[model samples]
Target: MPLDAESDAIGTLLLERGALSAEQLVAAEDLAEGWNVSLVQVLLARRWITLQDLYEQIAIYHDLPLVDLEADPADDTLVRRYDPAVMNRFSTLPLHESDGTITVATSRPGPRTLLHIRDLYGPRSRIVVATHLQISAALQKAFRDRHSHDAVFALAEQDPDMSAQQVVTPPQILVLYVLLSVLLAGVAFAPVPTLIALNIFLTVFYTGNFLFKGLLVWIGGAAQETSSRAIAAGAALLREEDLPVYTVLVPMFREPEVLPILAQALRNLNYPLAKLDIKIVLEEGDHDTIEAAERLDLEGVFEIVRVPPSHPQTKPKACNFALRYAQGDFLVIYDAEDKPEPDQLRKVVAAFQQSSPDTACIQCRLNYYNARENWLTRMFTLDYSLWFDLMLPGLERMGVPIPLGGTSNHFRIDVLRDLNAWDPFNVTEDADLGIRLTQKGYRVGVIDSTTYEEANVSIPNWIRQRSRWIKGYMQTFLVHSRRPVHLWRSVGAAGVFGFVFFIGGTILSGLLNPVFWAIFGLWMIFGAAAIEPFFPLPVLYLSLVNLLAGNGLLIYLTMVAPFRRRWTDLAPWGVTVVGYWVLMTVAAYKALWQLISNPFYWEKTQHGLSKHTASELAEAKAGGPEALAAAPMPETGP
Candidate 1:
């Protein structure tokens, strides 16, 4: 092959330059053909040669001069003239202009890139070779401000109605004022009637909420049984070469200790390592974790994405920033302590294949690895088991918009980007995105793959975490409920009902639980006459049903939640779920207050608190990904 020919052979060039062994060249050739990618891509993916060496040989082959982008950076003045997206996509940056001719630096230097450069920067444009990382770094340095601003305000600017930027819009505030004014007027004029009416409404709401939850569990349990089998079988038969490039985003802040565990888990994934575009998204200020990631010396597939310091430094904002550079057909978010099933990506791909074209996201189940660590962990596990393993699937079956868990949500990058990605203002951006996807004529699918996380064992930490979740739910409800007619039309009557009970009920129940408990306490201690004025005969009957049957149903649901997982020991602990509700009530009040005070604040959940953390880390480091996957559950006994 001629050095200057259009059909320059990269492998042959690498071999001639003594960059690759003969055996390695043959293997890379096979993978390159099977993966339907270029020989350069295969060589880079396999890490057969250092990037500099491979690019140098390519520079030699293409007869192009190689430039060090870092030593002599691109001119911001010239680079800003072209679209950053196009530049990033082509890995081409305008270096400088000389005599009306522009010099460009590109990681990909070829006829196609040559044409693109000439078309964009004019026919006088010239090309030079550089590494992919160098071009990416230059782009980031040049466009950080623009990308950061877009990440934070894209949804708010483009679709105000879908954003939680304004916690309560004018119409919503007016509705609240009208409702409060009506309640106050009724109380002043007709105290007895007002109290009775309020009692009836709340009693009915409680009854409906529990009943709705029961229906979901029943439906979800059935769906889980059938669908999980089909997904697993599909995943088993999937060929490694057919898998699409997947982007895994692990966003961390001040959590360096858990990086190793996360790294091992990603390596354990069954997907081809070369095709995985894993980005460890870290805040620019979080030098500790950033340094830790760098020291780990992860494989070439893993890249550290340094997010610029910005306000509302929440996970979603970090994720939004990282989403800009994602090079994958599909993207999934994992937390610092998450250990998803190795086949999760394959299962997600298979599920997408089996789903309708409108399916834009796949939500995998989330449970805790430290389920038996403490009372809180046990209850949290049962809660997740019900929410993920049961309720989400039921929501899918019934066509109700599902509330996505914080992690393990796999999205089609195109659809996600087109939707302006995540809302930075929503603390629970995942849940908000799920609802938004449904409203925008897209469907969210549920899969059986599970991502085990470190359950909160401490009470205060659990409350902070739960409070953030509830607050985000509050924000989601407010944002989506702004145009009630539009919501009803978009998601239909069933979706409307589900949203109200699922999101609204979650908020109201936590706030109202304490009041109901106090009311019941007074009725028992001070006699029925003490509460008789508030609870008329019919209203009293309804309140009694809500207090007895509603509570019982919730407890029963919690007990049965773990049965599907064959976590029978957790069933007995479910009886103490009332205690869990008390904690939720505390968190709910905190969430409510914060919604009024600090709606966008994200209460960071501290991981590495589990008693088994040290052991898990050691296992991950020593045994590798497979060992971590095959690790047995901790002893459930007291």
Candidate 2:
């Protein structure tokens, strides 16, 4: 509980090893701005320590307990010979006991911890060590290996893993109950009048979701223009060339098919090749991907970091592993399916270069390139169009922290690393990082650059991925709300409102929008519902207006997306966007259920690299006759 008791275990060991004086240790502690990063980071920044020296210190520091073991006369000589490797092989830590079971801490603990413990301890030794940092991890791995498997199963609820489940409704119990009460309360005014009030409520809500989206776009100004402006500002804010060298780490798992496409896309970034520190992070077990990279020998700009075999099984862990070696001015992440534009790096640089010191991240546009591939893709594309092109800009215009999507997000390298990079435990690390940055007095803004990606059209595939996204959003909401008063004070009322609009509103709308749609469908079928719908004639008329405005936006998106790509002929698919809403309603429900059942599960999306309509993509890429002339597929019946 006390900081110092556990704080400088290594620092004291260094003093004992003659690697650093107590005075030097104190100085290093004083310089470590939040008392988090290792002393080596401070010493390295000051050119006082070398990388080799740092690792050597850690190795010796770990050997301190062994030294202590040797000094104790009462200790058995066998204890002095106790192998650290035995514990490492078992993935155990040696935590001091306070209660039922103690934790064990060891560096580089492999996955098969139980087998090693059984081998060394002869299934008798109960004492174990775990990673010094993660106590929970060690306890589970060790206890599960040697102790009661049934007990672990009984404790499942304590840390039950959840994957995003099938989509369902949002948290509308309270809101709906209140609305229903109001409906009943208004019944005294007569059925027609009560119907009027109910109609007013639904109409206002339906209109609100639409307006909230439009408001984001209006406030942010044109997304494209804002992006272009950000190019200059971001670069200037980053101090342009004066910006520190930065690394961009992209972690891949089971993605050899999309790897080359991703590589080609990142290669197009405007950042100087020499200055661009791009690390293609890969899992240790993924030999096929490692082989593929080696075979490609994909230029010096791309470096592959095979994660240490012993790592938290998460994307963030892969990133953190690569981050240990990253050397750059800033860092950003892009998923495998992303196709960022050639000018995106410049845009991000401009935003940082020109923005205030408080700014920590700049989230660029993310839209699907193959949006017209299927009905699902079209619906997904529209959702993103409304989110990035519309909602994000509004948040930026309001000067709030926008919850960043998973990829094409840029951040100040030092600032990001200082915040512990990403949480390996958090599945939606990007969203969590956004909230954390905002909590820490940092700003998140929208940049103009657009990163195109593949949309999940397969029903199951889309469900899995969408569920994860919603679940992550739920985590973000919970994580931030855990400190509501603190969050409000830091981000202010407007920022908090923006947060609600983006996070709470998204989930709520997912449910509410469907109800509203259901009512409309009923009215369409019955010519008037059996239950007298509470709606004013004016509001009813406005609903039609809302419907038209909503439908019209489809045309806007198809036309708008082609502003640069100039696929004017394909703009006709905008009409299909109307039918696409039904798909979204279904997806939103699945996403909601997933939020409840599997909040942290990342339903993997399988990509179809085989859908490489090279001629079409080339045409889309050029935005010219060669590209445009290739033509889009004729409208298909789904």
Candidate 3:
């Protein structure tokens, strides 16, 4: 194959590299001839088979002795007891076994004699339990080695890159539904006279939402009086230097489109590059991402940690895998689509600097970056503006264990490790962890920081993404509420109220949005047939006033937030906030249904596919990775 003379060099290299022996390599080459591709390609094409594997008895065929790995004598703790009985639980993946020497298969060995096993066997071991994920990873590797996209590797792990804004309770949908439902139900019981009376429902719903928000804010403020005053006065309730180095773990799967954009945005973060630990985590089989990451000169700080293949393909497992190598003092997870305010790190630093040692976490705000993208983006932005700017603060004020948003949550590294990092089995591991933190008597503070991310603009993509979120909320609710009264004692009354309004309110809104939408449509179509939906001075004025007030709040918050971050451009979406909520209603409904049906499935959002002009692409190509940062969507507000 190597013109006879060079064949020995190739074999020697493989053997020296411990990839394979000369005879075994020759036999592999012969077996690989059936692949119609290169030897490595063939090795990849063959699923569940390790590169080091002597498949089809290549060793025996070459008259070589079986490799007995156990005899190597690397006695750590577990290896000290590497008899064979412990491995009996999992597959006895024969590494190499003899009377004196018995090699085993777990790659991940730990100090403990038994738990947290990394796979000892190579990636392509011959004797593997044929899990579907293993099959998928193998297929992906083979595809990458052959016919992958020009941007496939780069875009494979593309994400919107940020978390959603803080959450709100008794959403517009729930109030609207209660309003129309009460009035309409009353009207149904009566005659034409009751039709006009149905209007009371709308008033009640509006008043209820406002009243609920006001009351909760009041209660939270009262409870957090001391802390609020301290924060407001900028007194020594915290210190900045005390905060540890923070690592934000971002996991991506098949989101190659905006990979460059996300990396660039992160590079532009306020945190010092040396102090910041960013893990651009990828699934072990995601070679496209790994390859795409190769050319970019990440100066050691931003390392690519490949998630060893695991399934139900989870966010937590990726974090868990990357956590092992994290040298940070604290940890956070950011979505790929997030564009956090530049000074966000500064705020967190300040907050953590002054807080008590047990204050191990600081939750921040998540706001949409593209609130003005369309009608949908606008409503979505408004919803978020109210949540992060209003609800989460209120919740924090009340001292509740917030059902943590999926991203932008900071954690002390030691605290996280004490809790074993993220639970790989928990889908909404963030929420679960938050609850656990409270239960453990660790305090979580709030940082007035906003991580801007793209709202789901497309309907299908929006539904997929939103559904996973809703399902995760459901998971969080279930896991934490399992011990309800115990939780109440841990978080207190104000916290309980906050959880009901914020977390429970989310599930409620998703369930009730369609009902209200249906009623509003019916009133316009039938009940108010003689009356115009958008007419009459008083009605129009009231509607205008409501819309104006909502939009005004959004504009004010965005401007204030960005001003604090020194990025005034993001504040402009406030004007169009009214229009954005319409889109969220649609997403809410889809999320509700999917939560009941397919909870764990990730709704993949496609990025970079948005049409960029030839010149834009040219500019992008010219700047290489840096110029390609972030989507060109308007950051200006409503």
- For every candidate in turn, the CA RMSD to the true structure comes to 3.0, 13.5, 14.2
> In model 3, where is the ten-residue run with the lowest total lDDT?
159-168
lDDT of 3 by residue, 1-638 (tens): 22232233334455665666566666546644432223432333322244344222333233334333323322234332333223422323343334534444332122331232334433333332222122223222323322122111111132111111112123434665897887777667764445434334443444344445665544543444465445534523323323346677888876655566667667676554435667788887888877776555444346676665544467776776566556567787888766676666666666676698888788887877555566556556555655555556666666777667788998888887666555444457687677678777888777666787777667677666666666667665655555568779878877666566566666655565455456556667786554443334455344345344633543555444434334455466555643444555566676666555655555666544322323334655678645655445335422
Q: Give one digit per residue, the lDDT tens place, for model 1 in 1-638.
A: 11224223777787888889899988877776666556776666665688788888888888899899879998987888889878877889999999999999888787789889889989987889998878877887888899999999998999999999999988888989999999999999998899889988999999999999999988888886667788888888888778899999999999998887787788778887778888899999889998988887666678888899888888999999989888899999999888787889999999998889999999998998889888999999999998998899989999998999999999999999999999999999999999999999999999888888889999999999999999999999999999889999999999999999999999999999999999999999999999998888888898888888889889999999888778897899989999999999999999999999988888999889887887887886797656867776554311
Ranking by lDDT: 1, 2, 3
TM-score of each: 0.94, 0.61, 0.58
Stretches of candidate 2 off by over 4 Å are: 1-203, 223-243, 298-301, 308-313, 368-386, 423-427, 457-459, 533-565, 613-638
Clashing pairs in 1: none
- Flag the better candidate by lDDT, 2 or 3: 2
CA shift of 368, model 3, Å: 4.0
- Best-to-worst ranking by TM-score: 1, 2, 3
Candidate 2: what lDDT?
0.59
Relative to the true structure, candidate 3 has a C-alpha RMSD (angstroms) of 14.2
Using lDDT as the measure, which candidate wins?
1
Error of 2 at 336 (Å): 2.4
